[model samples]
Target: MAFIANMLMAVYQTNISDLFEVVDYLLMLKAPSFKSVYKWRLEQEHKLRERIHAESNKTENSHVMTDTEVWDFIQYFQRITEECLSEMPARANFLYELDDSRKIKFRLSNL
Candidate 1:
């Protein structure tokens, strides 16, 4: 049970780390404001850190995980990663559209 729990934590940490990296990449694209993205990224990172800390505490307290529980957690984590991955293209497109709108507004203002 402990081994399974550790494995689940490892899987979660790795996949979530990858997701954050992808988010950072998405934020690098031209956007109207870096402040919002930076704030959001910090919040996400804080939440991730808090979650990891809580999980570590639970593990250290010897909370056992049944095989079914482990399986369920793995499935949940995989789904979350997939959802994040699928949203990346949409986010990129939105950023592009935002940049285009800003350019159009600037041109209109000058005219």
Candidate 2:
């Protein structure tokens, strides 16, 4: 579970490229000891990625995220962070406030 916390810290405080390292760390958590938890996290991450990709491809003239999409993204991250924190509260306390920063950067870069 410490691994989950590490991954959340990386996600909350790092750039997208840097977050890739978090993904790698997550993969490490996929071992049998943590398989169920890791699988749940993977599903949540996959959904979040799908939503982000869809929003990113929208055209300015006719692009908008539904409330559901917004909700999904917010919930996705919340769940992820919560799960990590639950497993390792200490690491959650160390997260940098980079979540919004990374989100904005992703938006701009995609544009």
Candidate 3:
């Protein structure tokens, strides 16, 4: 999805306060959407190369990002997110229906 690509770009390129806000959402994608994400990853890798060549540094880290950081982040996030999605509902708060006319019920989990 384009939204996923944009969200990753924002988190990768900007100093967002929420360190890993929407990472869980990335778990929803299947095989077809992989190319968009792969493209973004390629762009980040290219940026890392350019930064290295130009002697550019970001903030206090003395580095921008390694080629594997994003991939590793995704791998870990995917595992944890999958587990949470499967198990968190059992630990969720009990939610009550507000009105008798409404049939649907759900708990709002943390993103």
Rank by TM-score, highest first.
Answer: 3, 1, 2
Worst 10 residues of 3 by lDDT: 26-35
lDDT of 3 by residue, 31-88 (tens): 2223334446657777776777677543345455565776665653553345544544
Each prediction's whole-model lDDT (CA):
0.48, 0.45, 0.48
Segments of candidate 2 deviating more than 4 angstroms: 1-33, 58-111
The TM-score of candidate 1 is 0.26
Which lDDT value does model 1 have at 37? 35
Q: If ranked by lDDT, best first, what sequence of candidates would result?
A: 3, 1, 2
RMSD to truth, every model: 15.4, 15.3, 16.4
- Shift of residue 1 alpha carbon in model 2, Å: 15
The candidate that achieves the highest TM-score relative to the unseen native structure? 3
Cα RMSD, model 1 = 15.4
* Model 2 per-residue lDDT at 84: 56
